[model samples]
Target chain A: MSDSKAIFLKDAAVNAADGDQRAFIRKALGGYYVNRDLQKARYRDWERARDAASLAKWSAVNDLAAVLEQFVANFERNGGVVHWARDAAEARDIILKIAADNQAKAIVKSKCMTSEEIHLNDALEKAGYGVVESDLGEFIQQLRGEAPYHFVFPCMHVKREAISELFTKHLGTAPTDSPEELTMIARRHLRQLYVDADIGITGANFLVAETGQISITENEGNARLTAALPRIHVALSGIEKVVRHLDDLSVLLPMLATAGAGQPMTCYNTLYSGPRKEGECDGPEQFHLVLLDNSRTRLLADPEQRDALHCIRCGACLNVCPIFKNIGGLAYGTTYQGPIGSVITPHLRGLKQWNHLSGASSLCGACTDACPVRIDLHHHLLHNRRNAAKEAPTLFDRVFHHGFNFVIKRPWLFAAGGRIFRATLPLLQKLPLPYMGAWMKTRDLPEAPARSFRDQWKNPDA
Target chain B: MPDARSDIFARIREALKVKAPRPHLKGEPVAGKTSAAAKPWLPDGGESAEASLAILAEQLAKLKAMLIRVPDHASAAKAVAELAAAKNWKKVAYHGHPLLRPVAAALPCEAWEADASFEKQRLEGCDAGLTTCESIVAQLGAILVSSASSGGRALSILPHAHVVVAEAAQVVPDLGSALALAKARHGDQMPSMLSFITGPSRTGDIERILVLGAHGPKELYLVLVG
Candidate 1:
């Protein structure tokens, strides 16, 4: 195994045993499930809605180039500029150039996992620009200098008291444990930042091809303020965010909210076509849409795993994933932290380095069932495992599999082997073999029967 | 940049070479076959304008937004005055739309003009904002406000309270119809910003507890006029 993969496994094991993290995940996901169930109940034909959304995404993926061309044309027609980035570094450079050109000193940003994917805040801060995260969850995570704990809820693992402490330390407010007070404190603090910011940065939920509008959905109204209050607006999005029609939001919006937070709809779903129009006074003067490929094309190149690109990022799989619930989002040590993350991270990064993530699953298929786009996630994990094994085979793996196959093929050898294994179970338990010891740490081998079932079947009269 | 775009497109085309070209998708892509095959889901009162208005009121009330129905523009004006008085609002910022002239005229407060040149700092100081919506969505109880007609964006967001002046005819059954209306009205060139404001700004990010007015308006009131 790679050194980073080994470290990741060790860290994941420690995080899985953390009682507080586990409790937080359970409570938060439990509430999420309740809300999802209630909101999903409103739809008489939920499955049909899912299918329609899936088809729309599939169509977009199939004709991505044409759709993106159309999007660029339409957006540019509305006075928006579009840039193409082959990877993260290019995406970051393009953004920095925009900031430098505009002489921006301060930037306000909305919650965008895409921005997280590219480490945009770190780059911006390093360049001497004051950056403020406007989403309440993202702001909390930012104050603590941590990555998001969940896809939808960035600070889900953080308690109110911790947030109160964070605010007291950072914003210099009197410590208060109330969620409402903490939210208000953040709101009051970030309110001025929006007005002072020279630039606003955001991630798009969907890019409409028919109209070339970038749609963003939020509950706190920060995105609206971020886009509206600034002189320049830059939206950084993965090229996968495109949808074919404006009407597609009718299905995508509800599906995303119901799956992510169990709301009928988010409080705000705004579509931005471009910069301020000729007569408009409040929107950004310059609007730029940066389309980042960043290894998404690698995933698209594989026909078997291409459907994984259909992810809407609703994070339903994370909420329902057993492995995710136990190990938590930070355990993965990647920007994305669940089934969809596991499926695509290998392609986005390198497969050999990230193969361990695919092995983390129990293959419960809950993630597949939860997926709105119906990407066969567990099967894809199996495929990833197979690919990993093919890429790097060890001598021990070859020997063990060959020996097992030989014994299974011979009935007499298998019977004798089974009897010997049962008799030596206690001895094996005490053996200091590294692999065996690791397996026995949290589990015990089942007690061996007095006799083998095959032996008893052959000599029942005895 | 052009090289990168072409390279990405070339890779995509190579990957999709094995699949049959779907010629039927040439023109404007048709709405997905799935959406047409199975009847799309709609809320309880998402049938007609009258039924949708009732449902919109109920849904908005559940989201902590007040919905007041009036017989005509004059009554809507009266409702706005009563609401402002009850809330003890002393300063109101109103969108410079002809539809909202009646309410602005009847407001019992120092009214501020929300125009293209209106100062955002002053709008932030107002007690409430009065604006007109492009449409009201019944299923989600959302008010659709576009930058084209709503005196830009800050008028509806920066104030402590937001009061929307909408007409009964502007109510839509669901988000689908709302999008259709927007498309029909604007065609290919959409406004700079179009927002669907469901209620006062809110957040449940802290311990999954819902808190209203995290950043935007603390109160949202809808005055539906004939």
Candidate 2:
């Protein structure tokens, strides 16, 4: 491991342990497992629903992509301008330009990972606009000036005492550790910002092409205000988020619930198309959908890896990763984190810069099994490792793989090498171990067998 | 800007490629994939008057909304007058829906239409707000909010206490039925926002401790008028 990554992993390991990381992780996992099964049954009932009217209403799922295009077309037809961004930088620029055009002084944002990836709030603030994260987890992380740690729960890493300290220091309050009271304090503080925001930015969970609608699913109602209260509302999302029809969303909706929070659905599943109607009382006059590609086009180019595009960012892969449980999202050193991050980061940013992440895994195959749509993550990780070896191998790793390949390809040489390796066990143990030993410090290493089966078979008579 | 125009077209072309029509469709609409095994399910907008009222009550309870069974518009108006007088409320807004006119007239404060320009004023100054419900879902006790003449996005959102007046006839079985009604009412075009409000606005953002009324209404009230 690189020195920087090694240090990050060590620090995260300590923090996760100190914060009862194992118990927390286990709790999340247990919630997901139970919710997954319950949702599975719920989806089956939804699927088996027999009423003709109901069936026709839900057929949108089968035609999701088509529906999304229709939605885009309809939104455009309705004077709601739509912009497509191929990456985070482009998405940021699109939003920044919109804010500039509107001469926005302040922005109130809801729960949008796309905005987080683009660092939209910081970008706007750098341009001298005040940006507020209206979502509760987002608000907490905004105060801390830290990246969000969870998909649904951003400030999961923070304890009540820490928040009490943050509030006491920032808002000038007596240090009190009650979550309920702290929430009330935050509510009071954020209410002013919500009303005062000039622009609002959000992310779409799904875009129904058929109806020209952006669907936002949330338990908290902040997104409603974020879109409605501001003079301008901007929604940023990936290209793959489009479903041909809204009915197709039926199949995908339950999948998202199971994969996301393990609930049947969030409390709010809102769909917004364009600006307010002529007679409407309140809503933004302008709406913008910034469809981002990032490196997704490249991902779509490869059929084997294209399924990565199907990720709803439900974060099931991250929740189930053994590596992530120990080191946490920060150790990954990328916007997207955990097992999915390890696979997609190098691909998005390029293998040359982030090749080491592909080697970080033990290939336990937990991520693939945990994926709701069944993304074969372990195989993809291995493929990434192979590609990294070819595209950007270090001198030492190259030599190791080259030599290892030579021996493994030749059975006779491999058998002799195995014997030699057995003979040098004492010497190998006596010599000071390296980073692998560091890994072994936390985990138990299995002992070598007494003899190779081939050797034992050869000497059977004796 | 280059990414915006080109990428969209590129994605559109790719999508078209996937959905391209084929001769082998055999009237199946695609590359000969069989018709979906079963038809898609849509919501049926069927409910008895009794069931509808029951659903409205249940939804009100779920939202923690105050439910008062008032005899007519006069009594409902009286209740509002009492509330405004009791709380020392400064300003209030009411939707233009026919059902809400009496309540608006009864209130001591002036009422304005749902205008985006007045959102900040309504949000900050309004002590109580009222709107007519487009529909209500029985299963989750959720109220369907749409931007109609009398039902602005802000009516249910901006006020400290949002009072939604529901008729016994407007309740449905679930979200599917509500969405179907929405689609039928608005055509293929979705409104700027359709809030499925189940209860008062709340959040657990600070540290997973539930706090009621973050940026939206701190309190919700449902007036079930027969």
Candidate 3:
């Protein structure tokens, strides 16, 4: 991607001091509002336990870190193994070792962003294990052999006809766009894998340190079956996923519902702590939890950015983010793409590598407002820019910040500098403007009129 | 399990330097402080058991899942057989519920109880899989599945087609009510496999196109036996 396109948000921000951000916010707000109303009504029944249960759930979050460690100990004592990996490489090794030791031939996976972070599928597939993504969106992406576009809705970018064509090519059937036909096609195909698979892998939406149970929520029964049918089940989650108690599930579930899909709760909320007890007919015989730090610990250490840990991976921030809507997920150039991605990616991958993501947002506070846990996302993005500046400031950026600091400090030079730039715009336009002018490619730039906006405001009718 | 769960949580809290992250807990009211009227999980107001069933049926119907109203157990069994033949489902797997006996006997296709044989038969080719729901919740239109005796866990899940028979009396208002009923009925002896299915197996994974039965039963038939 062109640097301007790659850092599209940075380009957009240079010219977005006006009402441009507001227009983007208006569009995204429409989408969020429509989805929110639909979800409330759709999962109205689950909402009955909304108030009491959800409150209980948040109490657990208040004591999350403690609860999570307890959950890890319990899992180990119960004969379930727990592995802590500080980064993706370590996480992938832990999983690969488990898969190899078990002599896994084929594996099934539930949606787990942690696994995505570690690139578990490629690692496993490279070792010659057939891996299938059980979640419908994941499955579609898996079939196309691609990565998830969004955290929850992986194939949210794929259209229906595209899916029909995907199925037709994969199954050698006539292309059809009806959801029922496509579902039947996938069902017929995936059922065989459920029984035949040797290992099941999933992501935990919440790890109840209380129950030693990894809570996975999904509408399709795949996660349940994925975890249940396989002989070995592996759960991957970030350290921030833990909560105090099962009672806390009530609070978290509703928040996830409202934030993820606007539902009160998903259809399936399956919790598996360890291996099934005696007399249990289904579920894995072996259970493993890989606690991945993957920059979470570093993020936790940074007092300014630690709140990023509070994210439940609900994707609420992305759904409500104005910049995310127009750019879609692919532009972020990481497993996670969106407002949360922009803030977290630089921290996880280094601000120097992804300084562009820091400046990608419209700085609209919609993401912060929409966060169920109320993460200050816009503030974090600004914080990311600061980190980038400190870690990898360009010569131009250094000069600019120094010049900016000087201008604001010295009113005379500041005024003169503004006048000079405004007057020299015509001359600069003729000289083929660089970085700042890239913004004009996708957007129109208004000419600087003879009268300044500040001057006009002072005169009222100037 | 309770003690173990609690102990684990306690220790983890200590290890992680778990402090009370929030200033004040935000959740259910302190009992009487909140109005009793604040029933978030309940319908508009409250729905009677029967009314909940009606609403559930309507919702299921809207999803294109077939809900057959049978007068008796015999008719319910016959209805299954009729559906099997009508849908051209040849290889069939039956959860050995007493309610399904007549249907299993009547169907011309090969029938195996939810067992290893059923699993083998399913692998070969099955047009539909038949089972009886252990319970149904009206509020969310969910059906609970237990794989203890009749239905094998695999039979309910690892099939392209699934048909479930539920007693109208078993339908409750919501998940909480459903859990309450399960707790009361089982009294600590939970079933081996209890699955609550709302709509047919569904996924909006692809561009938000809600695809039904992606990994589980693609088509779900609910026979609401009166």
TM of each candidate vs. truth: 0.95, 0.81, 0.80
Error (Å) of candidate 2 at residue B136 is: 3.0
- Can you write out model 3's per-residue Cα lDDT over A117-143, one digit (the tens) per residue? 889888888888889987877888888
TM-score (0 to 1) of chain B, per candidate? 0.87, 0.73, 0.80
Model 2, range B41-146, lDDT digits (tens) per residue?
A: 2222126656656755654674566777777777877887777777777777777777777887888776654443455654567777778877877644667777
Candidate topping TM-score: 1
> B187 in model 3: Cα distance from truth in Å?
7.8
Q: Which residue window of length 10 is worst by lDDT in model 1 chain A?
A: A429-438
lDDT of 3 by residue, B1-226 (tens): 3443344344344434533343233453552222222344433312786687677876567555778899888888788888887888877887766777677887867777655443433433666778776577664456766655335456776667788877888776655555455546754344444556656667766445556666766688888888
Q: Candidate 3 chain B TM? A: 0.80
Residues A1-462, candidate 1, lDDT per residue (tens digit)?
Answer: 776588778878898889887888798667778878987888886776676677778888888888888888888898899988888989999999999999999999999999999999999999999999999999999989999988788888888999998888888999988899999999889888988899999999999988989999999899999998889999999998998888888778878888778888888899999898877768889999999999888888787888888888888899899998898888787888899888898889998899889888999999988887778899999999888778875676589878988989999999998988999988976776677645777887778888888879999976
Local error of candidate 3 at residue B29 (angstroms) = 5.6
Stretches of candidate 1 above 4 Å error? Answer: A451-462, B20-39, B42-45
Question: Which candidate number would show the highest lDDT if scored against the true structure?
Answer: 1
Among the candidates, what TM-score does chain A have in each?
A: 0.96, 0.88, 0.86
Query: Where is the poorest 10-residue window by lDDT in model 3 chain A?
Result: A46-55
Among all candidates shown, the one with the greatest DockQ: 1
Give lDDT per model, in order: 0.85, 0.68, 0.68
The DockQ scores of all candidates, in the order shown, are 0.53, 0.30, 0.26
